[model samples]
Target: MWSQTTDKQRNLERKKEQILTEIKAVQQLLKTEKTKERNVLSEIQDQNHKIKLSQDLIRNGQQQIALINRDVEKNQAEVAVLEKELKALKEDYAKTIVKSYKSRSSQSRIMFVLSSENFAQAYKRVQYMKQYANYRKKQGDEVREKSDALAVVIKSLEEKKVRQNVLLREAEVQKKNLEAERTKQQGLMALIQKDQRKYNDQIKKKRTETAAIDKQIQQLIREAIAEANRKAREAREAAAKAAGKKTGEKVVESSKGSNTAVFELTPEGKVVANSFKANQGRLPWPVSKGYISLRYGDQPHPVQKHLTIHNSGVEISTVVGTRARSVFQGEVLQVQVLSGNNKAVLIQHGDYITVYQNLSDVYVKKGDKVTLKQEIGVVNTNASGQTVLKFLLSHNTTIHNPQSWLSGSN
Candidate 1:
């Protein structure tokens, strides 16, 4: 039970550290954003994130305190039991010592052995005296061991108390900070609410733009799939000709249609597809350091509760000048320029595809092989001074949440 509690405490401490690091990053981003032209909605969102992190940090601290309290209570109980045992041991040892002192004379010891009915009895008496002396030594050792144990438990209890106090202080500080963030968020919210109509229009326009981009992306993916199937079909036909079989053989018949949206994988392509599928939920992040700013699918807008925002992919907010990296090794399928001069990189892992969008620049061209975590392009820092990488994952044209595929999503 004690070991389990200690493990829980250690885990909570680690979580607290992570929360603190996230809070620090949010603070730095907020500071940087403040230096630029202020976007009230963005500021509110960042402030809200910081507040959430602060609350997590405080809750983690409280949990740590709770574990420490459990430990302190357990140690105190142990100390009490050890003190009682030590006290009894010492009392018994003291009595033994006093009795031995009164009979400490060598003459008295010799008389003890001699007082027997016969020689056999006298030998038994001598053995009894030796055993008595050993018993006294054992009692003294017990007293010392118990004393040492009591001292150690007391020390441990003191240390736990100290840690508990420290966590309490830290939690208090976090609470204050959280309250301040909440106040600032309220102010930002008011400012946004005052111009809510303008902000809402802007958000709708942005959503329309994103929808168009998504449509373009889907079309590109379809084209890429068709191209891949065409190549596979060509290869099969060539092989059939080499074997003196008609080009209309059954093996080459599967890829005949132009409307085949899914990939017709070759043996090698099947291997890559299987490998990619096997690594689900363990793929690396598209960027080295960032937090998911916007998750996949439909979510309520941050400021406008009535408005719903649909995201085709997850948006990761990263530091400025951060380069987007490949999550896995794949062949670059397409590098297309989208609206606003932003670029998107699509890499194909067999039938699986990973997309990195909103890049300011591109590094790889079509059909180029890229390794895992290879830097592909710089993520664009938007007008609001936020550098975000919009990442998507899919099997053929079926979209999957990138967060679920990325490592440490839990």
Candidate 2:
């Protein structure tokens, strides 16, 4: 009886522990969904992960519940068998009591012993009495043992019933969590679609922005060229007497020899590149409070028909007046007004260059050092009122996928 009770207790504890583990996984899913708004790409992926986790949890819970159900059925069967045995034992015990108390009671037993004529017969009678007493005692003990066992079986059945209730509740909770995660996944996908439209607007804005910056860059380069010429002339005149080379001739020779190169270090571009490389998986969001639409490189448009296009940078659609922030530290290389009243700011980090295009105005200039996540410009919302930002990353001439470099999920 004691061993049976111990086994039942152990089984219940095991099933309870399994359910607890499943509940923890469901909690993580709930927490992950809250961050969906800040990072759509990450949230979408995270939702997919959460759904998988929920499914696994549900699978485990169902298995445990099924096992427990089988155990309950077995317990019921055992209880029925034990109850039948107890009924038979009670009837047999009643029959023994009737026989022991019949007319052949202790008076007859005493007379029978006295009627024995020889000592041998008397001794045999005495042995018979002792045997009958032992038999009655054994029967009484069997009845007590059977009754005690029946009580234990009844209690076990009750405990199993309680366990069944617990299992049902655990299964129900797992089912609800699974459904909730899938619904959240569908919602996230819809948001991505909405964000994609915003991203398209960002691309168009970028083209306009690049054009505007090109003009400003051309004028700046021309000024730098003029300054170079003046310095060259001064150096040439100073060296004329010593080397017997005319200023004009020396300038021509230097140009022909390809020796008229500037040795000035571009600390800004180098810094941006270094910072960008250093933060392979830790770059800030391109368009704050937005989602990535189409990533960098060739990808078919979500709504277009079998058409593919190349992307130098990613498009992020945002709410109106969303500011484009720097993903890494760099100096403002150019801020140009693009076509369609758009603008762009090019921030250089080391060898890496980040272009936040489509803006209304520029804030920083050529030599100003910007830190990581610094705001470069506000994304331009065109006449049509489309709010999108174009984000581009390039290491020298090679374009990089911002998706791969950015954080997986928020």
Choose the strongest candidate by TM-score. Answer: 1
Off by over 4 Å in 1: 245-255
| Model 2, runs deviating above 4 Å | 1-37, 103-105, 195-410
lDDT per residue (tens digit) for residues 215-238 in model 1: 999999999888877877777777
Tens-digit lDDT track of model 2 for 235-287? 66557655655433532234422122221224553454565687887887876
lDDT of 1 at 265: 82
Task: Compare the candidates by lDDT and give the number of the best one.
Answer: 1
Model 1, CA-based lDDT = 0.86
Q: List the lowest-lDDT window of 10 residues for candidate 1.
A: 246-255
- In model 2, which range of ten residues has the least summed lDDT? 256-265
